[model samples]
Target: MTTQKNTDLPLQGERYISREFFAREWENVWAKTWLIMGRADEIPEAGDFFVEDIGPESILIVRQADTGIRAFYNVCQHRGNRLAVVPDGSMDTFTCSYHGWKWGLDGACLEAQDAEDFTPNPCGHAQLEELRCDVFAGFVWINMDPECASLKTFLGPIWDEWAAYPMEQMTRVQAISVRMPCNWKTVQDNFHETYHVATAHPLGLNSVEDDYRLTAITLYEGGHALGVTQGSIPARRKFGDNPSLGEQIRMELQTWDLNPDDFQGREYETRIALQARKRQLGPERGFSHYNKMSDAQLTDTFHYTVFPNFATSINSDGMLYLRALPHPTDPELCVFDCWFYAAGAENAYTRLLTENGDASRLAGPAPREWRNYGEGTLGVILDGDAVVMADQQRALHSRGYKGSRLAHQERRVQQYHDMIDRYMEGYRPR
Candidate 1:
């Protein structure tokens, strides 16, 4: 729970938009740090595989016959052709369409064409390059650097903080990926703080307090950070008029089997009452995980920023996971993923929140949805952030642009870049 504000660090536009900087990130930051691929539930069976592309690197994560998860470079050893062309599917062995080089799910060379024609047989001796892979909280994580620290050590306290929630069992009801025309850090910086919530997302004011003083920004080792604010309460600051708050509260109350009218004049009590009510009746409602959550977690939003690209806004019932990944070659373009996971899929409380949203849909066994930036599939709040990022990207190329002037609340943003600098300057395998 350490909190410190360091606003003195300057963030330059070059770090956001320069091609050279993007290359540096691939070499130092993304390459050396652990990254979340996706939920392991997506590939529960043997031979189930998924491909995650970050910058120029494409990784194949697959479930082995022994039920273990293994990750390897998607490149073929024959001619460097990509082994797995599709995003995800079930595959017993990866056969390169080019030279017919066959590779096992364990990334070992299984067979090859014209073995006698070569100076030396490449079978069994040549294996697919494998990266360090591990699983935590139901997500499959991969580190390009083989010497990278363990995922638990890399996650630090954030791992312990999220251990209570049933993240491993949570169902990913909705997953949407959008291509935004901005540096990935633009969206990453935005999620690190709530300073723009008052103006960018006024409706959020109803449920989230926008005052910076009340927001506890906690930074951890490995460049991770957490932004905590009072949730389930009305905004401390007025933002003209937002009529949706009542309906939202009413919907939540109805879902929890509480009468909305009972808290007509005492809307502030809704959060506390819901916490106590859930604590009492949670097991019967299929939320057995509620027993593991703290009272604050039952009603508060714990927003966690996992180093470079991943961020999660977690609560008792569900989580809104956001990730911004860099493009392979274009520094000005990036992909944004908006995913929703529910703590208890069969329960009314989790279903009520995840069932009706443009950004996310009802949790079931389904593949993720992918769309372009302006497709409007990301919902309002994320769509708004995308629009802001586009304009910010365009402005960064202007000659007058110098660096970002950050406020104290944006100290996490500063800390984020400072961490990036450390990575860029630290040990990188040659």
Candidate 2:
């Protein structure tokens, strides 16, 4: 399990394709880690549910009588037919499609066809398997191991670092289901570095909106490393003349659109309000601007990772909610979903998400990088990410590239590897 150079320390090939390593991950990583289950707001009403799989288990995200979200095994205790087939919806209670067995959101087994045969009515004795469910930021996260760490400690100091962006404020713009060939880690790791930015998002680099890069990376002891980039630029310079240094700045000045007022005026205009704030705040200060703003000058982008399995991209206009769930026995084949949340652009959201008509204008090319994965696909964003991850998965199977080195400037990526090693090596136990 030795890694490559410090910059490229994470295992590329073996970790990606080895069934043995994938098993170890299920036991060590997926089984114990605080994995994201579903968006919190999606199931805000009572009895709403979404089925998500983590490693070897199918997690049923449930909305309780108290209007709180809970996680349960989506299995029937009697016959084991999957309870909820649809990915998401609302229900008074869940009835097994196979048998007429029923359970409430609290997981109480309320009904069984024949009660007399099973003695004490089968109500309290059999309940859907329950797991620890905690709501954080805007998503529901569940842990299979009841003895795992609290979400706060698991996230380390990410809150202070992400204090500014109004994460809850942004609406879910798009929710897309895309299945990729690569492991979830492959995609997550790919996103955790700007090392691939120059090549991966060359058009993304030179867009008119904002300049973003790696300076926003964060590494902690508990396998948590966040690499974010802002979409901002200087007053005199064009985009990319001097790219953004890190994730913090990306959170501050990235291109985000919000609910337009009656007159359609955002907090700040692109040239004056947004860039002025970035230049004034400078690069030294981490994003804690929510309290500092006058309420009129708070437009910003927030592309941040919340530990183990969630990454959020909040632009001034809207946001992209990304959830990476474990892929059962085949860790490399995890399910990735994206939800776009926008303030005033639900119309635009639907159009861009659907890639309605030649939407490539939405994504500007990166002048610095070159591997435009979703070339000529019109204008959908998820297609681009899917193309990149699937291709990376294919490359991982290749024997030609074992692993490589990382630049010291990419400390966040290094820190990410160190965290993974710490956990896999048995040093940091949840």
TM-score of each: 0.93, 0.74
lDDT of 2 by residue, 132-216 (tens): 8898766677888888778777777764554444445444434555555678776676556555555554444432233333255
Q: Candidate 1 overall Cα lDDT vs. reference?
A: 0.81
Per-residue lDDT, model 2, residue 133, is 87
Q: Give me the candidate number with maximum TM-score.
A: 1
Displacement of residue 194 (Cα, Å) in model 2 is 1.2
RMSD of 1: 4.0
Q: lDDT of candidate 2?
A: 0.59
Model 1 lowest lDDT segment of ten: 1-10
- Choose the strongest candidate by lDDT: 1
